[model samples]
Structures are given as C-alpha cells and as structure tokens.
Target: MDRIRPWLILVGVFLLQFFLSELLAIRYYRPDFVVIFILYFGLFFGSYYGVIAGFIIGIFIDMTPLASYFGLSPMTYSITGYLAGHLQDKYIRWSPFAFHAAWLCIISFHFLVFTYVRYQLLFEVDIVQYLLRWFLTMTYTLIFLLILQFFFPIKRIQGA
Candidate 1:
C-alpha cells in the first residue's frame, strides 16, 4: 500500500492535469504536476526511489508525445528526482529555507534544460522570453505544489 500510493498519485495527476487545463481554460502558464510528484516522492523515499520514479514518469510523458526531444525529459527529470532525494541526507537535510532553495533550483534546472535542448535545434533562442516563461511556469507549479500538500500531507509515524 505504501509503495503504491505515490505511483497512483502520479497517474492521477497526469490524467487530472489534462481535464483541469481544458476546464480551467488555462493559458500562458502551466504547472508540471508530474514534477511535483517526483519531488515529493524523492524527498520522502530517498535517491533510489526518486531516480526510478523520475525515469518511469518521464518515460510515460515522452510516450504521450509530450516530449520535444525523445529522451530529454527522462534525463532531466531523473536528475531532478535525484537531487530532491538528497534532502533526506542528515548532513544537508531540510531546513525550511534550504528545502525551498533546492526546490527552486531543481525546477528551474528542469525548465532550463528542457527548453534549451528542445529549442536549440529550432529557431534562434530568445533569452528574455525564455527566462520569463521559466519564471512564470515555475511560480505557477509551486503554487499547485502548496495546494497539493494541504490535501495530501506527508504521513509521519510517531515514535519510529
């Protein structure tokens, strides 16, 4: 049951995101709910689980024809998951500020790598517009992440 929950959430988010987008008439910015799940699982389960989740989810997204490049998402998301899982390490574990900082960096890195690699083979890259898009998308995603936490609080056992 514990093992299945996160994967179920990932699938739910993937399906929910489509309906939510069309229903909400969302435009301009979109949050990556998949990434949020990856982050959460990574943080909770540590690096091994994180890498596996990221790769599996990323591969699923690519198969949906969502990827601009065939393997970019798997590569990037796997890295993001690995980093997020690093938060579990005692030596550099979560302080409120450090957690947020790491979150920001991972998301930003995802967007940057995803965008750049995809667009590099296309037209000239517009740095300003790219940065603006990155900022907005990252901000919107974080907001969704906050809401997600309210509904799905991390389960903590007492006196482990």
Candidate 2:
C-alpha cells in the first residue's frame, strides 16, 4: 500500500491534467500538463521512473482527443522524460531561473515534435499559423509554470 501510494499520486496528477487540458481546450497549441509532470518526475526521480511515467502518460495522451498521431506523443514524451532525468542527475540545483529555463526547453521541444508529427502524419496544416499558435501556447505554458512553481514547489532531495 505504501509503495502504491506514490504511484497513485502520480496517476492522479496525470488524470487531473488530462481532464483540465480537455476542458480548458489547451490542445490547440501549448504545453501539455502531462509533459510537465513527466519532466517534473524525471527531474526528481531519475531515468527509470521518468520513462515509466512518460510512457504511461503518453499512452493516456495518445488515447485523448488532442492526440492526432497514435504513437508519436508517447515516443517523444518518453525521450523527453528520459533526457530530463539525465539532466537532473548531471545538474543538481533548484534555482528559479533554472526551473524556468528547463520549462521553456521542455515546452519548446514538445511544440516542435508535435508540429512535426502533425505536419507529416496527420494533416496538411499551415506552418506559419502553427508557428504562431505554438508561440502563444508556449508563452501560456511559461506563465502557468511560473504560477505553478510558486504554488506547488518541487523539493530538492539531499545528495540527489
């Protein structure tokens, strides 16, 4: 039960984000809450857990209406989570600037990957419009990250 508690929390977070994304219409262009959680876990827990969370969330995301391509999100999210985990290991600090920078990178990566997949696999969309939408979405995510960081801080573990 104790071991499963943490997993439940993680799952709960994912589901909350998923529902919010759907209800709030965050899928048009922006950072995914699932991706943010994946990055957060990866940064805190390490590669193995990050990969697991990413995979699970990716599956959920793929099943969502927002997902156009079947497997692209899962694969991209897994890679992003793994990389974030590795970065956390290499760089052990919790500065606000660092958090913002990391958030920007994650959001940017997701935008590019999603756009590419949509362009190549799903439909013929205008790149210029997509770019504009991506920019707006990324901006929104950055602002949201700032707000979230203040409200729910990420605790740094000792010797981590």
Candidate 3:
C-alpha cells in the first residue's frame, strides 16, 4: 500500500483537477491543483521522484483533450518539481525569509511561463493582460497553498 499511496494521490488529484477545474475557473484564473501535488512530492521525496512525478502527471494532463499545447505542461511541471526537490533538505539550513522567498520565486516562475506560453500562441496578448493573468493565477494558487499550510505546513522532519 505504501508503494501505491503516492500513485493513488496522483490519480485523485488528476481526476479532481480534470473534472472540477472548470468549476473553479474565474474567467482565465484557476487554481492549479496538480502543481500543488507535484510540489508536495518533490519537496518531500527529492528531485528524482519529483521530476518523474511531474513528467508523468504532466503527460497525463497533456493527453487529455482539453490540453492546448502538446509539451508545455510537462515541461513546466517537470522544471518546477526539480527545483522544488533541490530545496527539500536545504530548507532547514536557510532563514525563514529565504526559504519562503525561494518557493515564492519557484511558483512565480511556474505561473509566468505557463500563462505566457499559453496566451502567446493563442492570441497576440498585450503585456498588461499577460501580467494580469499570470498574477491572478499565481495569486489564486497561492491562496490555496496558504490554506494548505494551515493544515500541513511544508517543513522538514527532524529524523525521517
């Protein structure tokens, strides 16, 4: 069951994201629940698993009929996972501010690339609109992350 647990979580999140994401959408802004799961796995399990999970989950998402770009999701999610995974054990050595900043930057980069690539090809979007969409999506996702932190903060265990 231990081996299966992570995959189960992946499937659950994928299903939830697929079926329920539309309901969560407010115009172009919607929380990326899949990225949250990838972040969790990467942060806890390290880069090897993180990148793998990201790639697999991303491919699943891309395979869906709703996906626009073929390789965008996998590329972005894999990069974010690898970055998050590298910071896993190092969080303990850093100051609180620095740690938070690292994650904030990672999340910002993820949303920035995601939103930009998505809009750039579909339409010739203005800079203002691109920035707004990026900001709104990142903000919405961060709100969910904040709520998650209350219940289960992302911190390293003492002697795992």
- Could you say which candidate leads in lDDT? 3
Expressed as tens digits, the lDDT of each residue in 1-160 for candidate 1 is 9878878987887777644644543476767877887777787788889898889878877877445578887888898889878765432344656666666788788877776676563325577776776677777887887787688643230001
Model 3 scores a TM of 0.93
Candidate 3 displacement at residue 25 in angstroms:
0.9
- Stronger candidate by TM-score (2 vs 3): 3
Q: What is the lDDT of candidate 2?
A: 0.69
List per-prediction Cα lDDT, in the order shown: 0.72, 0.69, 0.85
TM-scores of all candidate predictions against the true structure: 0.80, 0.77, 0.93
Provide the lDDT at 149 for model 1.
65
| TM-score, prediction 2 | 0.77
- Candidate 1: C-alpha lDDT: 0.72
User: Which whole-number lDDT from 0 to 100 does residue 131 have in model 1?
Assistant: 70
Q: What's the ranking of the predictions by lDDT, best on top?
A: 3, 1, 2
Which run of 10 residues does model 2 get worst, by summed lDDT? 151-160
Work out candidate 1's RMSD over C-alphas: 3.3
Candidate 3, 62-132: lDDT as tens digits: 99976879999999999989998988877668887887798889899998888878899433647787788
